[model samples]
Target: MIKKLIILAIIVVIAVFIRNSPYSEYLTFSYLEENSDALLAYVSDNRYISIISYVFVYIVVAGLNLPGAAVMSLSGGFLFGAGFGTAFAVTGATLGACIGFLVSRYLLGDVLNTKYEKQLAKFNKELAVNGYLYMLTLRLIPIFPFFVINIVAGLTKLRLFTFFWTSFIGMLPGGFVYVYAGSRLSNIESPKDIFSPGMISAFILFGLLMLVPVVYKKVKGRV
Candidate 1:
């Protein structure tokens, strides 16, 4: 109990620090646009160091559920090209999501389970049956908040491996889009430029496609 409290406290402190830090200000499209030249130069000069630093920052931001993951994905493309950028962004996001999942499970899993036993029982059963499909559908859909998925999944009986692989695979398409956008950072004038209506529609269509199997299974079961 004491240990859990300490972990929770530490998470709170980190969240507060991230919220108040000036560094958070730099995680904006405008900021990246203004300093793209210098950032590119730095990455060019220190390629290995830059990759490590970028991945580390991405992990921290994603793990803490900070608000700059999208920007960071773009920055990865801006700093590296689409190939490396997508790889690094997906890797960092997957690892970061795992951290958030573990933390939520460790801190609040028991409490939530106790409080909502009946609700969680159903949820757990469903997860046990089709956890990966559900996770993939959630990941492919941009409408769902990424951090919320991480935190909520932790409170269930979802396995760590299931969470990790599903998150990685689910986030790949979006990661590629953002990182590719970042690669063309100079052409973008605003966030809207990165995700146009057409692109959003494509993502929504893809997400819905992933749900086909799940829907079919349910229909078949009823039949």
Candidate 2:
């Protein structure tokens, strides 16, 4: 517990520093536009440094559940291009999310489980049966904050490995979409344009297409 608190404190300190730094300002698309060459040169001249810096930034972002993840995603695209940026961002984000998950579990899961065990027993049983599917679904749709998913999921009956793999795979498509769009930042007007009604409608159609099998099963069940 003491060790966890210490780690959490360290993470918090780093987050605060990053929040105030110039990188935080550069995280915006407009700032990135104004400083792309310098940013790219820094990344190229210090490849090792860039990787370490990305991991640190991701840890701070996910650890604190900060609002700048989208900006970070864009910065990744600007610095590393689409392919490498997607890989780096996903890997760093996942690792950081896992850390946050462990911290939350260690701190709160026991107390909540112990207090609500009796009332939650039935829900736990259901979770044990379908937790992996739900995790994948949440990863795809992103109804909850990434850090929240990490912490709250630890309280469920899902296996850790199952959660990890599902999250990793399920996050890929969305990651690709965002990173690809980020790679085209010069063409974009605003971050809000990324999820305009048309894009959302397209994603909704794609989601429905993917759900056909489950819908079939449900309809058959009713018959």
Candidate 3:
């Protein structure tokens, strides 16, 4: 545990420094839009470099708890097309989430558990019993930030493999939706364009599609 904390401290320090650096600006949607052509060309010309770059960027974004991950997901689609982009997004996101979860768990989970043992008991119980369900719900609806979700989940008793695989599977539908939309880049002006009213409504509809199972389970339990 001490070793984990030391490693986590190093990661946090590095993440903080990177977040405050100029390169952080390049993580935004505007930067992505302005350099879309160049980014695409570069990725195409150097596939291996692109993979490493995406992994690094994704890890940093997750580690720092940044907010442009949706844009990055879309950008992946624009750069690599739907199939490869979805694959890239899922792998990178799962890896990033693992890194965030590890750091959060290593650095803070023990402290939180010790400080709020009684309060956290119920949560820990729920996580242990229904970990997969909770992860699926979050991945499907994304009612919270992915990195934040990962960090919070780390505070619970969810197994590492459970967290990893559930996050990967859960995020798939939305990842595919966004990436598919990105592949049809003609209508896209900016990342903002991706979240137009229609698209939001569609996302809501999709969320409802996912919520059906949850609602059914609730109703059945009540019966």
Candidate 4:
């Protein structure tokens, strides 16, 4: 258990260090914007290779909790268009999230469980009861960072299949938002324009609706 926790801690520190270091410069919007067409051209020239490479890289990024996934998602939209981009990006993100989840579950989960057995047990019970609504809320609301969700969800008794499906479906609203924003890249001056206020508002409203059942569950619990 101690060994597992130490390794997990090392991995997270490495991820944070890499993200904060100059190594992550390539992930910035400036870098992406300056080389957009070149990137598009490369992918266009190597379609099958691009898909495989893209998914593989996304999995690595997600699993390791590296930086630039959001930018990568936008790039997916820019290079692949909405339909294909959404499909691939969502698949990649979900798969990557699962990888992160597994790492957390295997490495840190037992330690967390041993340390906080009672609290963790209660939390796991609740998660089993409302994993869908809770995950959907987390996905749509942007209340938490994706990598954090990926790691934190690992410390639970939640089933892997449930985690995958919830993550897939829950991510759709935000995933499509990125894809659509990415698809309009040619017309916009900044990549950030894809997250316009109106669109954000729409997603927030949708998230709130997804939370209805969670709220109901919470109220019932309190009662």
Candidate 3 has a TM-score of 0.85
lDDT of 2 by residue, 90-154 (tens): 77777767777776667667776788677557656645644555566677777877787787767
- The runs of at least 3 residues in candidate 2 whose Cα sits more than 4 Å from the true structure, single-residue gaps closed, are 1-23, 115-123, 195-202, 209-223
Whose TM-score is higher: candidate 1's or candidate 4's? 1
- In the range 118-171, model 3's lDDT, one tens digit per residue, is 866876765665557767888778788787788778887788899889888888
Q: Cα lDDT for residue 58, model 4? A: 74
Residues 54-156 of candidate 1: C-alpha lDDT, one tens digit per residue: 9998998899988889999999998999999999999999999999999889987878768878876776777766668878888887566898888878888
Candidate closer to the true structure by lDDT (higher is better), 3 or 4: 4
Question: What is the TM-score of candidate 4?
Answer: 0.84
Candidate numbers, best lDDT first, in rank order: 1, 4, 3, 2
Residue 32 of model 1, lDDT score? 94
So what's the TM-score on candidate 1?
Answer: 0.93
Show the lowest summed lDDT stretch of 10 residues, model 4: 185-194
Q: Per-candidate TM vs. native? A: 0.93, 0.79, 0.85, 0.84
Candidate 1 segments whose C-alpha is farther than 4 A from its true place: none
Which structure is stronger by TM-score: 3 or 4? 3
- lDDT (Cα, 0-100) at 57 in candidate 1: 89
Please provide, for model 4 over 23-106, each residue's C-alpha lDDT reduced to its tens digit, 9 standing for 90 to 100.
688766678788988988999899999999888777767778687787777777888998899888888889999988988789
Worst 10 residues of 2 by lDDT: 125-134
lDDT of model 2 at position 37: 80
> Of the candidates shown, which would achieve the greatest lDDT relative to the real structure?
1
Best TM-score among the predictions, by candidate number: 1
Q: What is the lDDT of residue 100 in candidate 2?
A: 71
